[model samples]
Target: MVRTPQPGTHSSTDHDPDTPQYEAGAGGWGSLRGVARIFAEARSSPEALRILAGQNKPKGMMCTSCAWAKPAKPHTFEFCENGAKATLWELDQRRADAEFWQSHTLSELRRLHDHDLEKAGRLTDPLRYDPESDRYLPVSWDEAYDEIGRELRALDPTEAVFYSCGHAGLEAAFLFALFARAMGHQNLPQSSNMCHETTSVNLLKYLGSPVGTCTLEDFDHCDAIFFFGQNTGSSSPRFLHVLKDVVDRGGRIVTFNPLRERGLVEFVDPQNLSQMATGRSTPISEEYYQVRPGGDVAVMAGLMKCVLAAEDAGPGTVLDHDFIATETTGYAEAEAAVRAMDWADIEHHSGLTREMIEQAGRIYLSSNRVIGIYGMGLTQHVNGWLNLGMLCNLLLMRGNVGKLGAGVSPVRGHSNVQGQRTVGVGEKSAHMPADKLRELFGIEPPTDDGLNAVHACEALLEGRMKALVTLGGNLVRALPDRTRMEAAWPRLRLTVNIATKPNRSHLVPGQVAYLLPCLGRTDRDVQETGAQAVSMEDSLSNIYGSIGPAKPPGDNVRSEVAIVAGIAKATLPRNPNLRWDDWTADYGRIRDLIAEMFPDDFADFNARMFQPGGFYRGNSARDRVWKTESGRAEFTTPTTLTALGETPDGQDVMTLITLRSNDQFNTTIYGFSDRLRGLEGDRDILLINRDEMSRLGLDEGQPVSLVCAIDDGHERRVDDLKVTPYDIPAGCVGGYYPELNPLVPLGYHERNSQTPAYRGTPVRVVP
Candidate 1:
């Protein structure tokens, strides 16, 4: 039974008595602990120190962890806690050489968790899966490419899928998407499809462009910052300083999230020695509202409704009438929709009292310059697309767009994920600017739309998709529906992973599974043009060059560009028109091609990137230039809030929001401890509200089974999870992912964006 979005479902959290909470704010001593862990992992190697010194500097390596833009000035320690871990993890001296692989069998390795697999260290060579022995044996690059080319040529392009993670270098991702396009297939789906796809989808629908309208500079000028379902501190630690600066300048922040994130409550600057020494912390959020899971759309509605009510009292009281009339469309319809929403329904859906909603509205009304910030918490929902659309509507109502300290901001994860999308990685259904590809490549791109992650999973399971080639991500591990995706893996005829560290995905055998290890972001990527650099686009759309100081983890490790080009050069017709060799030889030539493709944005791409921090790619929305269909910012008038909820069925049903541990980034885990969250040693614990525990006849440390309530006609269950009392919204339960990913259904995604509802999954806890 696929459940409809409704009110009975509620999100919750939990905590344990033994593990003391991380109340000492972000950074400070916490970062020192992270550095210590990294030092231990790298064994205090000089190469590790060199990589650390180069991190986040003007000419330093990009932190492969998050997409937070670099600050104008470099502090003595520029990297954050997680950034330290990522740096050390990338520079890890451990090697899973041929000897290591020879010692471990697939059956034995499969027992290890995802983190253990990564801890096995960098793959030393290309590995081919041998089913008879059930182990991945070493294979030469030439043999791997030859086999991949033969397989690619044999299969119809439509039957194959190209998947990439955010960390793949710009040139590599460009060639990756181009390879798909040139092969006459639109089956290229990257990380965004499963995470921030809603941000792009709704932003594109409203403002013509999907990129953020404001830069980090706006953080300095904003009078007030409104947070919706985002914990900037743990996710993007660099942004914590921006929040602190906002408060230091007398700016107020309002947060709406189910869980009470430490960063939103208070923060201690790691750089401020006095404060660090004194143990004093700076409080961040002026007001915090524990909204229910999946309630972002309703909260936005309530806020807009309050704005409209104030508008009704005085024609232009809260609404920016001048800006509304001049810069937006469908205002009347959207206004009516807001007016039509009942106050009781708003209260019910938003999990907030009318007074609270009005209070938040008053703050918005008083602010001269306001900013809205959100993350996967808002976007990974059944109605995530509407959630973003409503956010855009709320911001536009106050004329928040195109001004200092005011805009709709989606804090994307991964360093270069946005760059991957910018370089045209997407299903042909939308997002990809295909005309540019045809014009630049002089090849006919596939006209028909292709499959995204979820759709591709279905295609693979249903025998429609036969082959899979991934550039950087652990596709099987990163995606939803572990039960089905596990089943879908064997259905593929061939699977190729261009990676650095081996993961569980490699162990999931295909008829032909090949692991081609590539140089990581921490490694210096040298090509025929001497030591080379790769360009990355930050969350703020800042395009910059990143050059690392360390050598490749293994001699067999190749550059991403080389691997991508090698596969393409071997697979395609002899001397194809696209010329894979030229781009592979000189990345500058690749930039030249990109400049030709995205002339307005990437013009003089190579020369501009030579500068310390690259320039902004420029968003038309920033200048009130709407690229939308109506030539103005469009407004969507949704009829009702999402009906996504589940009722207690004999057993109490809780809205389960799966989150990453502080020790993890995406699927990469540094260790078991989540120091920021007071969690350690294990990832199997469930977080439930203390008050809700009492109401539901549950207690701290009580073991229970989590069963997917929205059956989707599938059996998804994780048994014997010990519940911990946590500081979160009542009626919601929390668990770490991808442990809880099996609870999420493939069909459970926003219609507009197709982002899996990881934040609003319905599950019942049974004794």
Candidate 2:
């Protein structure tokens, strides 16, 4: 007898233990313990250990955690703690095979937490959601593709959304984009839209390109490094070694974040036996400023104001007058805007005194070459583009761009997100021009811009988008307005997921849903030609090869490149111009086509990829060659100083900053413990200032609920959140994302970029 599939539900009252503990520092014995725990839980074998050793090394698989640059001369152990977890998680012995899926009902699987779902192991076969049996049943690859193709062909091309995850390698992403554009639509919503879209959108306006200018080697020559809103320890732990080298060489590091992250304060390299044994740690930040949530704009303006004041006092001592005249434009307006900013307004909005801003300004003035680094903290705001404009203004004041050690660095989350965008996986045709597509492949792609993550969600909810085909990532969980998305998921006609494992996104199935299993970063991808290797691009615009060495658990799983080609072949009408079969068999054909598409960057794609440490895809900004309409860099002046314009009065609201746990990467929860924050066995705890807790008459571990202050008629709330006293700014609170994503309305987003405002969401904490 078939059982009824119950609707999936989430209870806000679910709570784990609220005990928060502490450790000495970020990476010492604690990181080692975390690594050991992950290995033990995975029941890792000696072969798994061999695979871990090859991570981040030359010609080996890149770490799937963050897009941090690989070292030119890598150490014996190039991977970090989180990298180890990601590696082992992919190398797990467990399997969610056909029998395993048959044993568990769809409703029962939906009840499992995201961490538990991942721990259930890698998927071994393609699965089709069986409504009569209320379970996922095994299906052949050809059959699954045929059904998906039929469904896709039946609908308008614009009604289908092709979502690309950051985990996809460059070759796979290229094929994914080629297939989407071949269908004559451009509804490609990617993971970049959520995190660093603002960086791309605003950088194009200011620097003529949407790429960071600095390379990994720039750290060696930098005199000072300024961190705007990134948490190096938790997000990109491997980059901490670069900061340590900077400090060891007499350089300075300045941090501006709302929370005093342990990684930023102190760090002990677990690979260093001397430091690990003695517990002697290297202090990371020379000066740390706890700027308010969404206060980066104010802080950046204040720094520029200080620079202008100093320039006025000394005439031509501070600003780079020559660079401004020859290399840039609109300096007069930018300077006027900075000079007009009120000190009181800057202090009120930034949560930093004038003396503090001046002190930071002094550090900037003293350093000859400065690298400005930031993360999602500056991007996931309503005024995120404005924040980047101000940051660009500050860097331009002293000619920071196109310098050896001075440039903008946005630490990306996914392993190959930037690379995906480089290969034309964006909503717009910025990277893929229509004339080039027509001239090279004789195919004319859609001219109109497509939907992003936010618009995709709205389209799905309103029934405008009929189908969703995801390459990877838990899209349902990663996006904001979770309550609405979860409720409206059933409205779609079809959903197809190409992934390595099961997650919440697969649980919320559409009418015709298919879970197509694919090879992971650690799984060997042997194509028709031979053992295949995929390429990836780091945040610094360096492209390298990644060849997985581990064996696959089953032969049913296919390579992402092959899977994308299979769908394309089954769906699109056969054309003599396209060679889908050859491209699937040999990825070199794809690379050759990519070279033809982006000749300037990928002229010798395959050959350059074989070089040691890979080839740099040279940024125009780094070469001092601005490609703007005016043929020079431009300065921008923001109209507002506050990130999220003035909050309403008489509302007991705190700006809630969504954070990721040290044990987590993006939406994939590694474990319940966040050792750096001294939190264990819980992911539903809120971090607030002690004074704010006292003011609310709440004690540590007190259960409370958060309600969005926006009166959008939607009761966006998360209840039963344990309040823990923390060192965050008074008016700011911190909590993990996806759990609190429900409070972030779909309508509330950056105006120009459309990136969700996940960083500075105002919410009222009620007991």
- The clash count of every prediction, one per candidate, is 16, 1
Against the hidden true structure, what lDDT does model 2 obtain?
0.86
The local lDDT score (0 to 100) that residue 364 gets in candidate 2 is 93
lDDT, candidate 1, 1-767, per-residue tens: 22222332332222334334786777778768877986797665877777777688777888898998886576777788888888888777889878888898988988998887888888778889888888788898899999999999999999999999999878888888888878779898889988998887788888888878879789889999899888776788888888898999999899888777777888889889888999799988877887888777788888998887787788866778899999999999988888888877877777777777788888888898999898999889877777888888999998999987899888989899999888878886344466776566667778898888888988987899988999888777778888789877987889998888888788887898888889988887777777878888988888888887887877888899999999987788763568877787788888888888778889999888846556888999998999999999988887667535343353366788898888888888788888777777888888876767787788788888898877556888888899887766665789998888888888888778788888988888887
List per-prediction Cα lDDT, in the order shown. Answer: 0.82, 0.86
For each candidate in turn, give its C-alpha RMSD to the true structure in angstroms.
2.7, 6.4
Estimate the lDDT of model 1: 0.82
Give the TM-score comparing model 1 with the true structure, all chains together: 0.96
- Regions of model 1 farther than 4 Å from truth: 1-20, 429-439, 643-651
**lDDT winner among the candidates?**
2
Question: What would the TM-scores of all predictions be?
Answer: 0.96, 0.96
Give the poorly placed runs of model 2, Cα more than 4 Å off: 1-21
Which lDDT tens digits does candidate 2 get at residues 275-389?
9989999988888888887778889998998888888899989999999999999889988888888988787777777888888899999998989999999999998988888
